[model samples]
Target chain A: MTQPTAAVLLIGDELLSGRTRDINLQQIAQYLEPIGIPVRECRTVPDIEEEIVAAVNALRAKYTYVFTTGGIGPTHDDITADAIAAAFGTGISEHPEVLAEMAERYKAMNTDFTPARRRMARIPHGAKIVKNPVSGAPGFQMENVFTMAGVPQIARAMLEDIGPRLEGGARVHKVQLRGPGLREGDLAEPLGAIAKAYPDVSIGSYPWYLGTGDNGVALVARSTDTVRLETVRGELEALMRGLGVEPIPDPL
Target chain B: MTQPTAAVLLIGDELLSGRTRDINLQQIAQYLEPIGIPVRECRTVPDIEEEIVAAVNALRAKYTYVFTTGGIGPTHDDITADAIAAAFGTGISEHPEVLAEMAERYKAMNTDFTPARRRMARIPHGAKIVKNPVSGAPGFQMENVFTMAGVPQIARAMLEDIGPRLEGGARVHKVQLRGPGLREGDLAEPLGAIAKAYPDVSIGSYPWYLGTGDNGVALVARSTDTVRLETVRGELEALMRGLGVEPIPDPL
Candidate 1:
């Protein structure tokens, strides 16, 4: 089966300004890649309405799915919901269903459900709410764009809630091996052939430093089938023996 | 002086795969931010040639300076140099001056200078080299785009070497204050006035959890001049006091 592609739009000024470190994109990639959904493009823009709308439209048209994180909080910069509604040519206002959910959640915690807190209940008309387990403010799903929270834990939870609902492909299985005393260029051609032979599998080579005057390289073979992934791993073991190097287990 | 805007292009697949955490963007931001250079946009693309070229062109056209990290290695996927050359419509090959520098550096390290290893000497036409003190492979500077290594230590070193050469504006001074018991919307109108009055400064409001169930809102003020920044900070502090909230010093 052909693998599906996805694109990520990470919106926040703090990330671009280097004030905040982004963990959402990596988490999203790790979650989707093993399931054979590769993220083809990743763009980071400031908390601006126009940029958010433009990125959403472009990525959603090009890829099967578009996942956006951030700008859904109760702050002034929280304009993602409105911007997304505008992009889809839909009207947005404070929805009663969302207000009930927030009111219930905040009431259970004995927090005041003030008008300020109620601002989070604003939702675009006809959008499905992706429930937030950790936080009261729920994310929304519209068409192919799944809006998730920016906080890593909440984003992860929201993705877990919505991931299975989306049609997913077979998981890509990979055997990753790493060790010291190897150069990446030396194995490129052989690895290239391995990639060509499988056609369905992807073999990637990465090099790292050991900080002890030694170099390390990792060879990963990713496919939809476990048996094919194992075969490639066996071949890599044989090649390692021929080069007098020991292959270490994947740590990442 | 008006601050110059900058952008980043992180070219690699390893980062997306979560195999490596990116430090280049943060380090570059730290270096430029103190000098009043605001990083506008950052995009992460794989080693694909077309994607790299498109990103380079787009970012270069938008910002005063565009910095790219990764894909300048001695491996096949290390294609940032070639792609940058393509983006500028220039040619790239092993330059004798770069080769000579690599040869001398290799001699000092007592490593064999093989022809394959000399691939690191390749540079685009009409490009100036950014010296790498730790590694023999030199980074290149073409027009506004500075292409550097993916290795975090090496990337940081190259920035230190090249940072002083670039024109920089006056550094922006900043102050931050947080009110643990207050909500963002409660302070919105007054903060709006603060933002309106300080046209040259940027004001931001962010929510944070202080553990032990203490949640709060933080207000930040930024400006190029130290006096104006302090004045804005004082105004924010007075406003927080009026709301019966204490302003805390920003760790940032």
Candidate 2:
């Protein structure tokens, strides 16, 4: 069966300016990978309405699911909600359920539920609210587009709330081995043959700094079938041993 | 004076797959900022030839300078030279200057200069070579596009070689202020007025988690003029102080 694929749209000028370090993509990738939702694409755009609308429409039509982050705050530059609403050609209104939850949360925290704060309750019509435990402002889910906060904490909270609701495929298991002595060209034919031999598995090689003025290649085998993954891993281990190097474990 | 602008097109599948954490963009941004080149846009595409050509054409037309990283290796996926040539509607050839450098570097490092490695000596016609100190493979500069290596170390080395050759504008000075124990609404009108007052400066506010069970707002002021930047910074600092906030130093 074909695994479900998703796409992420990161909207923010801070990211473009290199002012804010983005940790969300990595975290979301890790979280979704375990659930068998492979992220096919990730695009980061400035918090401009046209850009957001264009990206949302393009990604929404292409992927099974679309996730967006940033521009959802109660500030001047927060145009995510309006942009998404505009993408779907739908009007936004104060979601009663979200409003109630925000009101209760604010009251419990002894924070005033000002009009600006209520702006968080305004979500696209027919959208579901993704609960925010850490912050009062909740995320909204409409069709396949899940709009979350730019703040890492709030994004995580919303992700946790939504992850369990989505359908998933069999999780892929991965094995990795690292070595520095051998050049990539020497193993090209053998590596290609191994990948061809195991149609069910994928083999990948990455170059990295190995310290002590050394460079190394990390070979990885990934497959949804555990047996195939293990078989490929054994072959990689044997190859490393033959090359007079010790095979290491996958970091993940 | 106009603030200099640049756009980056990262050509690689490794980044899109989340396999390689990218350090090039951050490093490039930091390197260019002090010299007054502000990177306005960044896009990452797989090593597909057409995609690379399209990205190069689109970005070069939109910005003062365009920088590209990755796909300049000896592997089959390394089609940056050809793609760039296609973008320029030119042809590719094994430039003697690049071949000479590669041979010298290989001889110095005592490594075999294989035929596969020589593939990197090819450059797009009429393009200038960007010297690579750490490797035999040289990057190239064609029109506004500065194509460099995918590896952070090599890309950085190439930047050091080429940074001095580029034109620059007035370096924008930045100031930051933080206000905790306050909501965004309370500062919206004042901040709006501040934005209106300093038409030459750009002001932005971001909400942050204090990790002390409190929330905060990070206010940033950016401008090309040193006097205008300082004046806006003073005003923002006074506003924060009045709001009972002890603002922190610029996080940047």
Candidate 3:
């Protein structure tokens, strides 16, 4: 069976402007990896509405599901909800249920239920609520697109709720092989031959730099099949041993 | 005149698998941000050639420049060079100059210049080499697409050579306003008013979470015009002071 694929759309000017580093991409990708729905593509766009609508539509049409992070907040820059609504050609309004939740939350904190604060209650027509326990403002699921908060902690918390909703196909197995003073150029021929020999597992060689002179090559092999993954791991370990460098076991 | 726009493409399965966190997107964006060429969009795709080719063609057509990282190494997974050539419908072969450089470097280091090592010398036809001082293998520029090494340091080093070639339009001025206990919901209305008044400037509100209850909102205003940026900074400072929280001046 073909695995269900997903795409991630990271929204905000902070990320694109380098004011904020994005952790949401990895958070979502890692969450989906074991569930069998691999993230095939990821895009980060600024706060512009046109750009958001275009990216959302383009990605939603291409992938099985689209998970978006950022721009769902109480501010002028928080236009993701409206943009997603526009992309789907749907109308958005403040849901009474969500408005009641926020109102009760403010009452519990003895804070004013101001108009600006009420913006958080707005939801696209026909969208399901993605609960947010960290903050009162809940993320919503508009069809296949799931939108969440931009704050790293809040974004991460929302994923717990998002994980159970997705139906995954193939869980992947990965093995990373590293050795002392290993160089990619040195391992290219042998690694390439092994990659050609086994078409099922994808083998990649990456050089890791710890310091100026201290560096090593990390050989990674990944596959949906665990047996193939373990088999490649053995072959990689033998290859490193042949090169006079002992394979370093992963340090837990 | 409008400033040239750029997009970034980060290739590799490791990135999508969460095996590696990408810092290249921020590196390239920050490098281009001050140069007046803002990174309008950034996409991450796997080592698959079809995905790479599709993204490259789409981005190259939309933006003034496209900066692609990863998949330019000597390993079998390194298909960026070949994929890029296919995107442009151009032929690729081993460049004599690049081959000669790699051969001489390997000879100097008393290393074997194996057939797989020769793969790094393959450059797309009608492309210019981007010199790599760290490794003997160099990056190449094909049309408007600038392809570089995947290694973080190597990718960073290549930008020094990439920066000088592009012409920029406007250098953006940024002003960040933050205060103790500043909340986004409290600032939305006033912030939205300021944003609407100064349509030329893009105003953004991002929450900086220190701990569970120690979060503060960071108000950022960006504009190509310096006078407008300073004007908004004053307005934002006044807004913060009116809220009973003194504005904290930027440390740097």
Candidate 4:
């Protein structure tokens, strides 16, 4: 069976401006991988309405699932909910259940339910709420697109709530082999031949420099089929041995 | 004058598969910002030829500059150089100078100059070389797009070489005010008013939790005009005071 594919849309000017480093995309990718949905593409666009809407429309159409993080705060720059509504050509207003929850939370904190705080209740019409356990403000899901908060803790909470609902495909298995003191150039020919021999698997070589003297290349092989994956991995080991190098399992 | 805008295309499957958290986008954004160039959008695509070519074409067309990282190493999966050549509809072959440099580096390290290592010397037709001070393999520039290594240190070195060649616009100035023990909802209305008051400046509110019981919001104001930026910052501080909160300068 073909693996399910997903895309991530990270919306924020802070991320693109270098004021904030994004942590949500990596978390989302790792979350989806074991569930058999791999993130195929990820895009980080500014909080502009047109850019957000365009990215949402394009990604939603192409992937089985699309996840968006950021811009769901109670401020003027927080325009993600409205943009998502615009992308779907739907109306948006304060969701009644979400408003009730927010009102209760604010009351417990001895705070007023101001219009700005109420803004968090805004949900695209016909969308289901994705509960945020950390903060009272809940994210919403419209079809296949899951819109969550930009903050790492909140986004992680939202993902935990959404995880059980997803239907996954075959999980991909991966194996790594490290060639210490070996150059990629020496292994390139055999690596290429091994990759060609196993068309079903994806083979990647990554170089690493550990301090001043320690440096080597890591060979990673991934596939959904365990048998084929192991077979290809054995061949990779043999190839490294032929090149006069011992292959060690990557510590990572 | 309008600031020059740029886009970054990060090409690697390891990024999408959650094997590698990208450090290049943030580095690129921070590098370009002080130079008066802001990265407006960034996209990460797996090592697929069509996706890389398509993103290169699209981003290069929209932004003043495009920076692509990864897929330039000497491995079979490193197809970025070839994909870039295809993106510009040009031929690619080993550039003589680059080949000579790689050959010398490999010889000094007592390594063979294998065909795989030679792959790093490939350059698109007519593109100028971007020097890689960390690694012997040089990156290239084709019109508005600057291709660099995936490794952070190498990419950093390439940016150093490319910086002097870029023509920048007005550098944006920014100021920040943090309102301790203040909620975003309370600041939203006044923040909106301030944003409307300074239409040319971009104002953003970010919420933070201090791990203790403390939580507050940070207000950031950005503009190309230093005088206007200061004026807007003062207004923001006054607005916070009016809301019965003291505004502190952000530690960052």
Q: DockQ of candidates 1 onward, in order?
A: 0.49, 0.37, 0.70, 0.75
Tens-digit lDDT string for candidate 2 (B124-237): 999998988876588999988899998888999999988978898888778877677656756765776788799888787788776786788888877778899889988888
**Regions of candidate 3 where Cα sits further than 4 Å from its true position:** none
**Which segments of candidate 4 are over 4 A away from where they belong?**
A243-245, B243-245
Per-residue error for B57 in candidate 4, Å, reads: 0.7
Scored by lDDT, the top model is: 4
The number of clashing residue pairs in each candidate reads: 0, 0, 0, 0
lDDT of 3 by residue, B1-252 (tens): 978999999999878877788899988888888889888899999999999999999999999999999988888999999999999999999999999999999999999998888999999999999989888799999989999998888998999998888888789888887777988888889989999999999888877878877778778888999998999999999999888888876621
Error of 1 at B209 (Å): 3.1
The TM-score leader among the candidates is 3
Arrange candidates, best lDDT first. 4, 3, 1, 2
The lDDT for every candidate, in the order shown, is: 0.82, 0.80, 0.89, 0.91
Pick the winner on TM-score between candidates 2 and 4.
4
* TM-score of chain A, all candidates: 0.92, 0.93, 0.97, 0.96
Per-residue lDDT tens digits of candidate 3, residues A80-163? 999999999999999999999999999999888888889989999999998899888999898789999887778788888878
DockQ winner between candidates 1 and 2: 1
lDDT of 3 at A122: 92
Q: Which pairs in model 1 have colliding backbones?
A: none
| Candidate 1 true-interface contact recovery | 0.42
What CA root-mean-square deviation does each model show from the true structure?
2.5, 3.1, 1.4, 1.5
Interface RMSD of each: 2.6, 2.8, 1.6, 1.2
